[model samples]
Target chain A: MIETTQLTKRYGNLTAVDGISFKVEPGQVLGFLGPNGAGKSTTMKMIAGFLAPTSGGAKVCGYDVESQPIEAKRSLGYLPEGAPSYGEMTPRAFLEFIADVRGIAGDARKRRLDDVIGRLQLEGVLAQPIDTLSKGFKRRVGLAQAILHDPPVLILDEPTDGLDPNQKHEVRALINAMSHDKIIVISTHILEEVHAVCTRAVIIAGGKLLADATPAELETRSRYHGAVSLTATNTGEARAALARVADIESIEIDPQDHRITAFPKKGRAIFVAVSDALKAQNVTVSELALEAGRLDEVFRTITQPQIKGGRA
Target chain B: MNPIATVFRRELKGYFATPVAYVFIVIFLILAGSLTFYFGGFYERGQADLSAFFIYHPWLYLFLVPAIAMRLWAEERKSGTIELLLTLPITMFQAVLAKFLAAWAFVGIALALTFPIWITVNYLGDPDNGVIFTGYVGSFLMAGAFLAIGSCLSAATRNQVVAFILTVVACFLLLLAGFPLVLGFFQTILPQGVVDAISGLSLYAHFDAISKGVLDLRDIVYFVLTIGAWLYATAIVIDLKKAD
Candidate 1:
C-alpha cells in the first residue's frame, strides 16, 4: 500500500504542493493528472523520498518515508522526470549499476536484468552508450532500470511523455501488465492515458487536489455524458424531428461537420429515443455515437475555473 | 553487496566509461612528471630523496584534483541523475562517502603510476626507502583532503565550471594560509595566537610536515579531520541544494 497524508511542499513564498492526501492499494494503477507545473512531479518526488515534504509525510508499505527512508525506498522503484540516467554507460552497464544498488545479486540478478532488458527490448542497445541512444531507447532504458528489481511500489514521472505512438502503446501495455500486484503511480497530462491504464486518477491543479475518481466516474461529470451525436442526410429535418422527443433536453449542430447532437435530460437514455425519432422522420443517418463522456471537456470544466482564479 | 561498495564500484567505473578518466590520468601524470623533473630540479638537488617531487604536489593538486572532484556532484545535478541516485535505498552520507572514495582512489591510481620516480631515485643513489614511502602516504593523504574539499564545493552548484573555480579558490586560500607572505601580513595586524591558529588550519603546513619525513600523529589527524569535515559538509550541501 502507498499512502500520503496531507503532504505539502513549499518553495519560499510559493506552495508547490498543497496538503494532499490519498492512498493506493495493490493491483491498482493510480494516474496523477495535472497541468504543467501543477506539482505532479513534485508530489511524486516527495513520495519517492527524493524531496522532503515541508509538512506531513508519506508511508510505503507502512514504513514512513522521512523516518524510515531506507526501508521505504527499499520497497520502491522510481523513474524520475526525463528518465535521467548515467549517459556515459550503456543500457547493460546502467542496468547493472541499478541492479547492484537495488541489491539484486547473483543468479537472480542476471535473471532480473535479462527480464527487464527483454521486456523493454533493450538488447540491441545494450552495448551502446545511453548518450548516443535515441529518445525512445533512453526512456526504455530508464524503465528497465526502475523495474530491474521488481519493487512493489513503482512511481514514474511522465513515463510515456516522449515516446512515439507505438512506444506509448508498449509502455501502457507494460504498465497494465505490471498493475496486477504492484501499486503503480504514473503522472501524465495526457487524458486518454487515464482511460487506457489508470484504475483511479487524482487530478490536481494549482498544487491542490481537485478530484479523485475512476476515469469512468470523472467522465460522467462531462456535459457530453449520455449525449447522442449523428451525421444525417437532412440535418435540419432531423433536428426538427428530434424536438418531438421528450427525453432530449437540448439539441446542437456541429458548425464544421453539421452533425446533430441530442442531449438527454438527467438520468435519461437518449440513444434509443433519438434513433426512433430519426427513423420516424425517414432521416437517413450516416454515423451515430452515444458518447461515454468527453474527458477533455470534463477535465477543462474541473480545472479551468482554478486557472482563471490564478491559484497556480 | 554493501551500498557504499556498490555505489563506489559504479562511480569508479563511471570514470573509465568516458574519456574524462583517461584524460585526467594522462594530464595528471604529465604534469606531475615535468613539475618534479624540470621545475623541482630533481637532478640538480643532488640529494638521494624525492623532496623535489613531493614539494610540488600541493601546487599540482590545486588544479588537477579539482578537475576530478568538480564533476563528482555537479555532473549528477546537471544531468538530473541526482534524483535517481538519492532515491535509491542509500543514505546521504553513504552517497557522499562513496563518491569521494571513488575519486580518491582514482587519484591514488594516478599517484601510484609515478612508480618510475621511486625506481629512478633508488637507482640513482642509496635513498631512504622509508622516507619515500612516508612521502607517498603523505601525498595520498593530501590528495584525499583536496578531493574532500572539492566534493563539498561541487555539491554547492550544478555548473562544473563554477564548482571547479570555487574549489580552486578555496583550496588556494587554505594552502596560502601557511605561506610566509600571508602569515607576515597577518602577524602585523592580528594577535600571535590568531596567526598561529590560522597557520594550524593550513593544509600546506600539515602536508609540509608529512612530506619532510616526519609522520607526526598531529599531521595525520589534521588530514583525516580535514577529509571528515569536508565530506560531512558535502552531504549537508547536497541535501540543501539538491532540489534546486
Candidate 2:
C-alpha cells in the first residue's frame, strides 16, 4: 500500500534519507529499524506527506505524496515521534477532535472513539488533562488518536517508546490484531521489537537502507559470523580431544569455569564431533550446544559498526 | 455548508472547550467598560460619537490579539501535532482559513461583550447609535486584520514568545507607518506619491474613517483586502513549513 522511489531527503549538506526505495504491501507489519539519526523517522515522514523528499517521491495507496498529498494523507494514519499531543486537552477531548477532523460523525464517531479508548484502556484517565497524565498514558492517548480514523495505512514512529512492559504488550497486541487490514510501518531502534512484532524487517544505517529481510533470514546471516560453545569439566582435556574434530576453527579455555568454547563455521556438526571426542577422552561434558544467532546480534553487527565509523 | 465549515466549527469550539474563551471575554468586558466610562472619557467628552470607545481598541488589541493568536500554529509545531493536523482530508487553504476565522470569531465574541457600553451610551443620550455600530464594525475588521498578521507570524516560529514579539513588532510597524515620525523620515527618501501610497496602507487611517461614521466603500474594501492579503500570506507560510 506504500511505495517509495529513490527517495532522498537532504538538509543542506546532510542527506537524512538517502535515495532509499522500499515498498510495504497491505497486511504487512514492516518493522523499520535504524539507530539514532538513521533516517527511519525521516523516511516515515516523507511517506506520511509531512516532508517533501528532495530527489524522489513516495506514494501512499497509489497516490503520490507530493502531487496528491491530500488523498495520500487521507488514506494514512501517522503517529509522529515523541507522540505529540495538545496538553490542554483530555484524552477523550483530543480523540474527539481527531474524529471530528477525520470527518467521522454521528454513530461512527462515537463507536470508534469508544473502541479505541476501551482498547487502549484509557477509560479511567479519559477525562484527565493530558499534561497531568504520565508519559505512558499520554502515549496511549496518541495511539488512540492515530487509530481512531482506522485508515488503511498506518505509519507509527516509535509506537511503544515510553510504555511500561504491560502497556507495550497491549500496544503490540493491538498492532498485531490490526496487521491483517492495514499496511503498518513501525519505525523503532529496538531489535527485540522487530522480532516480537514485525513480519519483515528493514535495517537502515547512516541514512541508507542496509538490509531488508525476514527475522529468520537476518538470524541466518548472523550465524555466518557466529561461534559454537562446548563446556566441560576439564578444559585442557576437552580442548586437546576436540582438536581432532574437523572445522574446529579455534578454542578458548575459561580458567575460572574450566570450560572449552569452540568457534566453528559448521556450528552443529563441529559441536557434535567435539562432544564425541570429549566422550572418548573420558571428560564429562557439562554443556555442549550450538549457539544460535539472535536478531539482536544481527542488528548490532550490521548496523552498529557502520554507525561507529559515521559513514554515509 | 462546506466541509470548511466543519473544520471551522471544531476549531471554534476548541477555544471555548477550555478557559481561553471565558477568560478573554470576562477580561475584555471589564476593560472595555472601564475604558468607555472612566479612562476613555466618554461622559467627560460629552459627545454622541463613540470615538472614545473605538479609539482605544487598536491599542488594546496590540497585546490582547497576540495572546489569542500566538497558538494558531506555533503550539501545533512545538507539540508536534501539526503533522496530524495537516494530514487530515482538509486542504491547507481550508485549514488556514478555518484557524483564522476561529480566532477572528473569538475576538468578535470579546468585542460583543462590550455591548454594555453600547447600552450605556444609548441610555445616556440621543447618540448616533448607527455611527457607534458602524464604529464597532470597523474595530472588528481592524482586529481581524491584526489577528491575520499574528497568525501568519505564529506559523513561522515555534516559540510563542517569539511569535508574540514578532507579531507586536509587525503590528507596531503597521500602526506607526503613517505617524509623523515615520512620515518625516520617509519624506526625504521617498517621493510624495509613494509616501502617500504607503500612508494609505496604514490600518489606522482607514479605521479612523470608519470610526467617524463614514461607510466609504474604499475604506471597507481596504480592510477586506488587507485581511485577505495577510491570510493568503499565512497560507503560503504554512505550506512552506509543512513538516513542522
Candidate 3:
C-alpha cells in the first residue's frame, strides 16, 4: 500500500505541494491529473524519496519515506520524470547495475534481467548506448529498469509522453498486465489515458487536490454525460420538437450542420426520449449519436482559472 | 554485496565504458613522466632516486586528479541520473564514499603504472627503497586529497567545465597555502601563530613531510582529515540539493 500524510513541499515562498494526502490500496491504478506546474512531479519525487518533504511525509509499505528511505525505496520502483538513465551505458549494462543495487544476483538476476528485456522488447537495442537511442526506445529502457526488480509499488511519471501511438498502446498494455494486486500511480495530462488504464484519478491544481474519484465517477460530472445529439433536415423543427421530451434539461443547436443536442436533467438517460420525439414528430433526422462524455470539458473547467466576471 | 561496493563497481565500470578513462590515463602518465624528466631533470641529477619524479606529483595532481573527479557528480546531475542514484537504497555516505574510492583507485592505477620509474631507479643504483615507498604513499594520499576536493566542488554544479575549473582553482589555493609567495602575503598581514596554522593546512606541506620519509602521524592525519572533511561536505551538498 502507498499512503501519505499531509505531504508538503515548498520552494522559497512558493508552495509546490500543499498538504496533499491520500492512500492507495492494493489493486489500484491511480492516475494523477494536473496541468503544467501543478506539482505532480514534485509530489512523486517526495514519495519516491528523491526529495524531502518540507512538512509531512509519505510511506511505502509502512516505511516512512524520510526517516526510512531505504526501506521505503526498497519496496517501490519509480520511473522519474523524463526517464533519466546513464546515457553512456548500454541497456544491458544499465539493467545489470540496477539489479546489482537491488541485490538481485546470480541466476535470479539473470532471469529477472531477461524477463524485463523480453517484456520491454529491448533485445534488438540491448547493446546500444542509451543516449544514442530514440525517445521511444529510451522510455522502454527506463520502463525495463523500473520493472526489473518487480517492486510492489510502481510509480510512473508520464510513461508515454514522447512515444508513438503503437508504443503508447504497448506501454499501456504493459501497465495493465502488471497492475493486478499492485498499487500503481501514473501521472499524465493526457485525458484519454485515464480512461484507458486508470482505475482511479486524483486531480491537482495550484498545488492542491481538486478532485478524487474513479474514472467513471469523474466522467459523470461531465456536461456531455447522457446527452444526445442529432443532425436533422429541418433544424428548427427538430430543435423545437426536442423540448417536448421528458426530463429535457438543456438544448443547443448548431446552425451550419443542423445538429441538435439535448441534455437530460439530474443524470437521466435522454437518448430514448430524444429518439422517440424525433420519430413521432416526423422529423427528418440525418444523424443521431450519444457522446461518450466530454472529459476534456470537465478537465478544462476544473483546471483553468475562473474569470471573476464569468466572461471566459 | 554492500551498497558501497555496488556503487564502487558501477562507478569504476562507468569510467571505462567511455573514452574519457583512456584519455585521462594517457594524459596523466605522459605529464607525470615529462614533468619529472624535463622540469625536475631526473636523469641530469643522476642521484639514483625518484624524488625528482615524486617532487612534482603534488603539482601534477593539482591538474590531473580533478579531471577524474569533475565528472563524478556533475554528469549525474546534468543527465538527471542523480535521481536514480540517490533514490537507490544506499545512504548518501555510501554513495559518496564509493564514488570517491573509484576515482581514487583510478588515480592510483595511473600512479602505479609509473612503475618503470621505480624499476629504473632500482636498476641504476642503490637508492633507499624505504624512502621511495613512503614517497609513493604520500603521492597516493595526496591524490586522494585532491580528488575529495574535486568531488565536493563537482556536486555544487551540473556543468563539468565549471566543476573542473572550480576544482583546479580550489586545489591551487590549497597547494599554495604554504608557499613563500602566499605565506609572504599572509605573514605581512597576519601573526606568526596564524601563519603556522595556515601552513599546516597546506596540502604541499603534509605531502612534503611524508615524501621526505618522515611518515609522521600528524601528516597522515592531516591528509585523512582533509579527505574526510571534504567528503562530508560532499554528502551535505548532495542532501541539500535534492530539491533541485
Against the true two-chain complex, what DockQ does each candidate achieve? Answer: 0.83, 0.57, 0.77
Put down candidate 1 lDDT per residue, A161-191, tens digits, no spaces: 9899999999999999999999999999999
DockQ, structure candidate 1: 0.83
Task: Estimate, for each residue in B113-191, the C-alpha lDDT of model 3 and write its tens digit.
Answer: 9999899889989899999999999999999999999999999988889999999999999999978789989999999
Per-residue C-alpha lDDT of model 3 across residues A1-312, encoded as one tens digit per residue:
999899988888878888999999988999999887888999998999998999999999999998999999999999988999998889999999999998998899999999999999999999999999999999999999888888999999999999999999999999999999789999999999999999999988777888899988888888988888888888888977897887899898876775788888986888888888888899988789986677778888887872121100
The best candidate by DockQ is 1
State each candidate's chain A TM-score: 0.98, 0.88, 0.94
Return the candidate ranking by TM-score, descending.
Answer: 1, 3, 2
* Backbone clashes under 3 angstroms, per model: 0, 0, 0
The candidate maximizing TM-score is 1
Query: What CAPRI-style quality would you assign to candidate 1?
Result: high
Question: Poorest 10 consecutive residues of model 1 chain A by lDDT?
Answer: A303-312
Candidate 3, which segments miss by more than 4 Å at Cα? A233-237, A254-259, A284-287, A306-312
Model 2: lDDT of residue B214: 91
Candidate 3 residue pairs that clash: none
Ranked candidates (DockQ, high to low):
1, 3, 2
Question: In model 2, which residue pairs have backbone atoms overlapping below 3 Å?
Answer: none
